[model samples]
Each structure stands twice: as C-alpha cells, then as structure tokens.
Target chain A: MKKMLAGYDAVAEAVKACDPDVIPAYPITPQTDIVERISEMIADGELTSEYVRVDSEFNAASTAIGASAAGARIFTATCSQGLKLMSEPIFSASGMRLPLVLGIANRSLSAPLSIWGDHTDTFAERDGGMIQFYAEDVQEAMDNIALAYRVAEDKDILLPALSCLDGFILTHVQEKVDTFTQREMKEFLPERDPVHTLDPSNPTTMGAYARPEHWTETRYEVQRAVKRSKDKIGEAVEEFADVFGREYGLEHNGLLETYRTEDADVIIVALGSVCGTIRYVIDEYREKGEKVGLVKPRVYRPFPAEELNKVLGDAEAIAVMEKDVSLGYQGGLAIDLKSALYSNGSRIPVLNYIVGLAGRDVTKDVIKKVVEETKEMRGKDPSDIGLEEEERWEPLREELLPGDKDD
Target chain B: MKQIRIHGRGGQGSVTMASMLAKAAFETGKESQGFPSFGVERLGAPIEAFVRIDNKKITDRSQVYNPDIVIVQDSSLLKLVDVEKGLKEGGMIIVNSSEGPGDLDLETDAEIVTVNATDIAMKHLGRPIMNTALCGAFAKATGLVDRESMARVIKETFEGEIGEKNVKAMSEAYEVC
Candidate 1:
C-alpha cells in the first residue's frame, strides 16, 4: 500500500513486517517513536511480538543479543548516548554472529549533550563489527530493514546489522512510503534461518572465550564476514528489485551510489541524507555547465573502497563531505575515504568538508562553497586537502556560510 | 515548488500540522515532505517545522530558509523570533489569533490572514490543540491543499468522534478565512 509516514513510523512498520519475535526497546528521543509505534501495534494486536521496555540502552542491546542467540528474530533501536551505552553489546552481538537488526537514529555524540542529527554516533562504532547501512530517506529506511535481515541472516554472513538514518532529518520527517503485503514481504525477506541456536537439545556456546592465539582469528572471522556481507547485500537487493521493482544502485544492491561522476572533473563523496542535499547542489552547478558529480556511500561498514577507487578514478579531485569528526583526527568519513583511496593507489586530491554537526544546516550554498574549494585544488597533491596529523575542524559550519542562528 | 515554515512552541502540534499538510498535499497528487527542527525536546520552547510541496520529488534536506508561506500557531512568538524571516515578498502568513489582520502590524508586504484557531479548537474540540484549526486556516489562506483534503487527513489522523470534532474545528476556522 502507498502511504505517507515519518521515517520513524516507516522503520517501525518495516520492523513489524519482518515479524520479529522480540523487540528490546528503550525510549530515546527521535528513536522513541519507532518503539512507541511498535508498542501501539503490539497493544492493538496488529503485531504479535514481545515488546520489552528495558531500563537502559545497555539492557536493550543485551536483550537483542539474548533473543537472537535463542534463534529468535530480533529488532532494536537507539541514538547518540543510547548508542554509546549499547556499544559493548553491539560488538558482542556481531562477534557472536547474531542475525538481528538495530535501527540507529543518528545523533551527535555528546560532550555537552546535543540531541540533533549527526553521524558521530554511528561513525564511532565503525570497527565494532556490526554491518552498517546508511539510509538517506524513508523508502531506504523501510527497504534497508528488509535488506538488513536478508543480508545479515545469510548463513555465510550471520552477523548483526545496524541501519543509520539522520536523527530528526529523516526519523522525524514525513515522506511517502510504499508498503508491502505479507505475501510480498515474505517473498522478499524469507523466514530467518539461524546458523546456530542456544537450545538445551542442540546447545552451542556463543561468544565463548577465545585464547590469545584464537583471539586474532575470531576477530578476523568477523572482519571476513563483514567484508563478504558487501556482496550478500548486493544479492539481497537484486532479489529485492525482482520483487519490488526499485533498484538502489548499478550492478550491485548498493555498495555506493554515483551520480553524474562518469565525466565529472570534481567528485563529491558523502553518506546518509546529506547526499540528497548534494544532489540539489550538483544540479544547480551542472545547469551552469560545471563538471561536478556526487558519490554516496550507502554501506559504510564494508567501506566500498573498490567502488570508491573506481567511481572517482577519472575525476580531477575528490571532495569528502560529512557531518562528523573523528575527534583528534579530522572528518571520520574523510579519513576512511583517504585510506580507501591510498590503498587503492588513487593519487587524486581529496578535500574534506565537514559540515552540519549538532544539526547545523548544510544548505545548497554551503555545498557550493565546498565544491568551489575542491575545484581549486584540482591537480594539487591529495595531501593538500587530505587529513593532517593534528587537526579538528568544522568547515562549512564554522568557516563558510555561518548560520543566522546563534549556537 | 511551494515551501511553508510553521512556527510554534512545543506541545502546540506544529510538527503534526506540517505532517498533516504534507499528507493532504500528497493525497492531492503532489510530492511532499515535512520535518521539524531538532533540539532538546521540551514543552513551550520554540519549535519550527517545514513542509514542501512540489510537482517533482524534493531533494534539498536543508531547512526552509525562504518560504512561500509562514504559519504562526502562536501570535506571541511573532515578537520573540522573526516569524517572517526570509518569507517571499507579498507571500502570506496565517496567524492563530482572534485579532484580525489589522491587529497584526508586521512590516511586510506579505498577505496576512488571522483566525482565532485557539478559540475554535477549544470551542469545537474542548481543548486548545489549534493545529487542525490552523490547517483549515492554511487551506483557505493559500489553497495549497483543498479543504476537503484537510478534512480527510484530519479524520484519518484522529479517528472516531475526536476526528469528527477536529474536522469541525478545522472547517469553522476555514470558514472565517
């Protein structure tokens, strides 16, 4: 059915359609409604699932781990501080290879504690071993939850997954979403086939202690599964396309999505919903005959290095745009992208433009300024605009186009 | 493309108003998006929500700085923040107050439309959730979405007797415009 819903409701409905057996919920702003709606569905007898209102995010995540290990389909959600609170269980859930899904309503990691949208919350957990799917809108949030289950439950890739959507930007925003019937949903996302279970009849010790010698191997196994999940994501989305008639990327389910990068002189790279804003800016620039394009990395976990090396290979410069910082390091996406480029032997200069932390608006003008700066460094060493050893900055927010509002 | 900015304090349903407006617009075959500004969630704090209606899908996720319409659910906020900031010249603003256009002495050429939405909401719904009432004002003020669409969305949103009461509040507010 075609209906309009906020990103939160869309995700809640998608989780409901997955027919999850258990949901461990903690009320966090922005993310609170996703659970709230699901609770309503359960209370209204529309969805039959255990909605456990946990005391803390830590318990919420631990509950997911417990439920998933018991061969039950599981779902959970958190944001910002809540995400940090659940970090311990997040890593354990993936290492144990539990096929559950966590919805990360993206928010700024707090020092002074802000509830606005930013990538720092999810970005901080990149190495935690959970498959990360960055959704740019409501449709993607709905479809990605299905895709998350399809990819994570693959026996070869039985790992936990997290889908990140910008906090209020997408989570609170209402947009049109085309829902699926139970039959269609079952066809798209089949019943979960657990690889191992915690039953007394066929007990399997999960997250068991690994000695020093086996520790490295255990870590490598999760890394390998994460890397391999890249292809599984593509395969799942391919089947999703056959059933749903909507394709997310070229040739793959969606490693990264490229826009007009084929012949552009400067390529812009970004993640999450900011890519939509970049598209609007690209359109304005292209209308004036500027050779600028955009590359959106939908899967930040696998890092999409090969796709990045190839899609931006022909461009004169690469502009890495993000809304977060790696603290002592510069932009998180910028650093990872630079590492990807260097490992892939790309010599193209990469400019880092960090914008919109604490929900500072990333307007068309801010993007235009970043593009102009990247355009200036066309043939310079990639090091010129690359990450420095000691630097932390907010380029578009503090530098260009300072907002009219006081921080 | 049509952009509208809604200004209201927390607990006033400004965000819901934006969502309802988007739903109504989408029901009328226009692609629409609605969202609220993020901060510490609180009651009585100033909050702004935006709605964009276009023939094509909207891509710009930035805040609506320049809008075709500005809606003020609380007229007192007009003196607090620049409720009319970046409104297009000769645009329109619908204020939720009993004081008609003459009492609203804003120094803009934009058209001013006033309805006592709070009074109407209390009169019809027995509560002062003026969002539905203001939706009626918005429907009549700009015709961005039809009165029928607004009624349908309000009914679909509230349901049963409460929905009928909201529909009445909306219609009564729309009538004065």
Candidate 2:
C-alpha cells in the first residue's frame, strides 16, 4: 500500500526505518520538520535512536561524526547557512571516512538572507570528498537516504554521503512517497560490521596527523576511496531497486535521463525539482510538434561527462538551467555541464539560463520561452551568438503593495 | 490523479494531516503522495501540505498547482495566501473555521464546507491542534476516504488515550461538519 506524505515526513519515516543509532541535527528553515519529527519519534519511543538537539549545525555534524566514529550508524540534516557552518565538520567526517549520511535541504545562502530552495549551498561543498546525490522529489529523497547509508558504509567506499533536496520546494513540500517498512529496509541494508571502530577493545586513533612522508599517500587513499564511491553508489542503487521495485538507473554512470530528445533541435539540461517543470514544458512542446527535450543530470558530482555528451551530442542547441549562480562566474551546474561537453568536442551552442533562484517559481512558460529563445539563437553564427555572454542576469522583482514607499 | 492541498500554520499538524490522509487513502487501496511547504522555522507562519491520490502510479512531483480539494486548517489564510488559486470549478474547499459555509464570502463557485475543528479539537483533545479534527471533516466532506477508514488510520497513527481522544474528536467533527 502506498501513501502520500510531506517530503520531510517521508525523510523522517525513512530515517526511522533505517534505524540509525544516532541523529544529531540543528533545525533550520524547511528542514526543521524532519528533525522535529525524528525527535518526536524518539520521545514517543517509536524510534530508539539517540536524538541529539545540538547547539548548531557544526555541533550536529560533529556529534554525528563522534557517533559514527564510535561505530554506530549516524545521521544529520542541515540547509543553507547551517551547512556552511557545518563545513569544518563536513570535511572532518569525509577526511575520517566516518560513513555518515547527511540530509542536505539545499537552500540559498544568505546575503539578503533568503530561506528558500537553491543549489548554492550544496555547490559550495562540491569538493568536500563526500559523495553527493541530488534528489528530484520526496520519494527520491527518502530512497537516497537509505542508499546513501549503504554506500557510505561499504568497506570499499567508507566515505560520508550527502543527499541534497531543494529546501522549501522539496523539503517542506508534501508528496506521495513509497515509505519502506522497517522490515523491508532491514532486508535492503544488512547489519553494520564495525570494521575500524573507536571501541575500547580495539583502540584505534582516528584522524591522526601523519608525517609529510605519508601525508600524500593518506590523501591519495582518501581520493581512491571517494573514486570507489562512484561504483559503490551504483551498486547500492541497484540493490535498492531490486528490493524496492524502484530503479534509480545509478549504474549508468554518465546517466542523463533524456525526455523526448529524439529528433529534438533544442534540449534543456537541468537538475533537481526544476527538471520536473522542464519535463512538463517539454511534453507540452512535443505535443505541439516542436522537437524539444530535457536532459536531466541525475548525478551532479563526479560530473557525469560522457553520458551527458552522448545524450546532448545530437542536439543543435542546448539550454542549461541553473537554480543557483556563482557570482562573477557562470552558474555552477551550467559551468559543470559546459566542462563536461568541452572535452567531448561537441560545440552544441549551449545557452545558460539561470532561473528560479532562492525558491522563485519557474513556470512552464519560462521553460517554454527558454526553449524558444535557444532555438532562435541557434540560427545565428556560433561566434556571434556568444552563448556565455548572451545570458541576462536580471534582479528578481520584488512584489510591492499598491502604495508601498519602498518601491 | 487526485491532488489535495492543505493550508495551515507551522504549529498546526499539516504534515500529520497529510500523512493520515495518505494512510487512509492507502488503506482504501489507492496510491497517495503527501508533502508540506514551510517558509520559516518559526511557529504560526503560513505552511502548506499537499497530497496526491491516484489509481495508477504518480509520475509528477511538482506542487499541486491545481487541486481537486483545498483543505484550509486556518481560516485566516483565506485572506493572506491565494487559498483558492487553482481550485477546479466543482472542487471542494474544506475550511476548519467556526464560521458556517454561508458565512464565508468566497468568490469562487466551488463547494464550501466549514467545520469548527478548533472547537472539536480543544473539546476532545484538550488542545488547539485541529489537524485530526479537520482530517475527519475532510473525509466527511469529500468522501475521499470513508470515515471508518480515516478513524482507523488515526487510531493506528496515534497511541494510548490520545489516539482514542483523536478518534472521538474526528467522529464529532464529522458529525457536526
């Protein structure tokens, strides 16, 4: 039987089923419900986990790190500023290879302090050594949590994992999610075998500063473990599919899901929840006989280069939509996509359209306009088009009351 | 697919309501999805929850821009947010208000059903969390799930005497609504 639930509730239920020994989280906008629910479960005796209400996100990550180092399956959640605050511990968790799973409610980093959805927070930590997986919706968020744990705990890939979800849009939004029963999850992920634990019986010093003689090699070992996570994630995803009846296609490494791209002149590449809107627009345009499609990159990190190249090779033009931007540089996702295609030698006039930053709505009309504009620009000379320069970064218009003096 | 949107504040049980609604729908052999939208972490800020129930698989993951039913846990939201934004013509609006259906000056042509969920919640549960009460009224108004099934789901979700109190509150709200 299937039921609908809020994204946070779904995540909470998944976390409950996973039965992590410790959950240390500092509540933030959009992600507060998840921790709140988990805390409630612990109080009500529904969950036997140690619910740690930490002072800050830094503490939350540190607490999880401590629990994980103590050989217990641990979990934590944060968003936006919280994630930034927890960066030090995030790196420590990865450096120590603590095998912790953190739920990141992807939110916009504040300058003007917007507590909405965006990829900037996650993008900032791209090189943190933790395997990152972007979830498109609530169900994916729930599934990714369990998969993240499995992959992180794998002996070959004993690295931490971060599952990203759009803060308010995906985190707080309610949707139908296929929540696995505790029994089902147990079947999917077996009991953890404490390999390198901080047990008194086996005293092991974790995160010891190695001499320069072996520092480079230790770093190389960490890199190798992170690289191995690519396969570990794929294997865990496949195993999850076998048990849950939902396949993530994680094995298809450069796995970019193409929608209606067959015989398409223009294609839009996007990630996270915004891709769903793009898919809707593509479907509508396809109905109107306009050969347009969407190339949704499932794996954002370890950048899916070869797969995106093959999927986008046939298109005359491509539009990359990003929900977050890196000031002075191109949008993070757009830049990554551009680099992915660069080595492929496919100069498919890729236009970068940064839309829906900080939780602003990206309507189907906006997606349609992007596709139409991309198609029109494809007719111009490659040099004249200047795909990068063509991007128009307009400030978001603030809605003012009828007689507001601020306006 | 049948999409239902619930509007409430942060302290309200919009998330719990969506979960119970989904659980009830699931009990009736329907595929259902539920999620919530919260702006700030603070209590009493406007929060929204969504539920999608379908006979087949649910592919769409976007917010329910167009809903077949709009469950308003806070009547005050009717003045703040566009509560009736994408409600279908014949769609139902279930408001947990002390006001009667005729009392509301709703501009839309959709059916309006009102229940004083707060009163029932406070009277039965001894608190102001009207989510379970509103869920009962929602089931009563839409017939999306039978009252018995909703009560059963509520009982299973809650525990001890609180579960029985919520069930009674739901029954009272259903009858009154």
Which candidate ranks first by TM-score, i.e. highest?
Answer: 1
- Across A265-323, the per-residue lDDT of candidate 2 in tens digits comes to 89888888887667767878888988998887766765767778777878888888887
Q: Which stretches of candidate 1 lie over 4 Å from their true place?
A: A386-407
lDDT of 1 at B111: 88
Tally clashing residue pairs in candidate 1: 0
Best by DockQ: 1
Give candidate 2 regions above 4 Å deviation. Answer: A1-3, A19-22, A40-54, A66-71, A181-207, A210-217, A254-256, A377-395, A398-407, B1-23, B35-37, B41-53, B56-87, B90-104, B111-143, B157-177
Q: Report DockQ per prediction, comma-separated.
A: 0.82, 0.37
TM-score of 1: 0.94
Interface RMSD of 2: 3.1
Give per-residue CA lDDT, model 1, range A211-329, as digits (tens). 89888988899999999998888888788888888788846448888888878999998888988889988988899999999998889888788877778888898888888777766
Displacement of residue A5 (Cα, Å) in model 2 is: 3.8
Per-candidate TM-score against the hidden true structure? 0.94, 0.82
